[model samples]
Target: MSSVSIHPTAIVASGARLGANVRIGPYCIVGENVVLDADVELISHVVVEGHTHVGAGTRIYPFASVGHQPQDLKYKGEASRLEIGERCVIREAATLNPGTAAGGMLTKVGNECLIMASAHVAHDTIIGNNVIMANYVGIAGHCRIGDNVTFGGTVVVHQRTRIGAHAFIGAQSMVDGDVIPYGMAVGNRASLAGLNLVGLKRRQFDREAIHRLRAAYRMIFSNEGTLRERTEDAAELFKDDDLVQDVVAFITSASDRPILVPRNGQVASED
Candidate 1:
């Protein structure tokens, strides 16, 4: 007999693969193409459907929906997939959807993520490890969220946006563009505030490194020639700083959305 523990009221398709020590709680539904890796736990009333793969040690709270169809109008019932990495905690009512054909066919959430209640991660979204999506946050389709990113409650990220690692989005913000690594964005239509100094400090970044990053930030956001020119100059000046290098690289990369910067006449103060 299989070692998986499944409640009598749970509906698990025969074709679903449940690894040892997996637990399916009451009224939960596991679809035919689903795979729950070892130690995965679904609390009551969770629905994991479609071609979803839940990684080991992940715990999903009641009423969360995983691997559902894309909300995209262009999606046509294709066989796309959703992959959740290990040790994730998906809270109640969170919805994670699969990718659309036009988006390369997969939506992915990396390890150690905490997706708070009622958050919606739309089709084709790629979330990196250690991300935190606060309650009621909504990420539109095709967004790329990097590792260690933090989204405050009710923040809405537009489609195709790229949020770099260690970036912070303030509560109730509307993000429609690219946020550079270690940057802080705030406001309805988000604008770059400054470096996420508090975040970096909490993460144990060295003081000297933080100092250099602040200098680089000033150079990049200066009202100089063009953003490209400023970025190039910052890159050259901070070539020895790894964190600054990441910010410069993100700025220079080709993105579908424009880069987020401070609003006109608003200057970011040094940390």
Candidate 2:
């Protein structure tokens, strides 16, 4: 293990594992089962408790609470864990809780994620790589957030919702359903606004792929047939288009929450 720096005011339990160049700032508290990987920095007044494992190169700003017991009422002193991936930035006053026995016993935040100030990641939630949650975003328990998803400030997601990769939730939206990959949702009781065209362009998706995805999206959401039938038609029609296939597969998958629809359309549940 490389040299670790501990401020005199910090209280790191003896059983905690600190990797090389880890810095525990003043007034921080690290619990016995906490693991801080190499180059991890707890800026100040941070509390890392429970069986939390923070990956290398992560920075936690002041007043963040990590690896804490879940907010679930059923979580009765279970041995759950919170695993944060490398190079993530957890901003001030963010709360990340561990999973519960009912939901796999692990809460995972993937690499390169940016969780802004006052964001709350609830019990059993799984957040994928490169996700960005703006300030005051609250994700309820058992939610799944895919890679490159971005949430504007103060977005609140209901429990068990699944948001696919590259999706965007506009500020102050209340998300209660599944959001498809590369989709954009907005407004209270969030509805699918459109394709995340800007995100696709920023990610440099080819023009042809974007065009096909748009075409398939229109077909699948059209009023011609049931959603399941439309999804099946899209799957067959866009067999060669990976982007279209991804959306089609997401629609076909079984989920408790309905797939978000356009602002004026009926909710798209499995037909």
| Highest TM-score scorer | 1
Model 2 residue runs over 4 Å out of place are 266-271
Candidate 2 lDDT, tens digit per residue, 104-220? Answer: 999999999999999999999999999999999999999999999999999999999999999999999999999999999998999988898899999999999998988888888
Q: Candidate 2: what lDDT?
A: 0.93
lDDT of 1 at 160: 98
Clashing residue pairs in candidate 1, if any? Answer: none
User: Considering every candidate listed, which one attains the maximal lDDT?
Assistant: 1
Q: How well does each candidate superpose onto the true structure, as a TM-score?
A: 0.98, 0.97
Candidate 1 on 1-271: residue-level lDDT in tens? Answer: 2889999999999999988899999999999999999999999999999999999999999999999888888999999999999999999999999999999899999999999999999999999999999999999999999999999999999999999999999999999989999999999899999989899999999999999999888888888778899899988988989999999889999899999998883558746
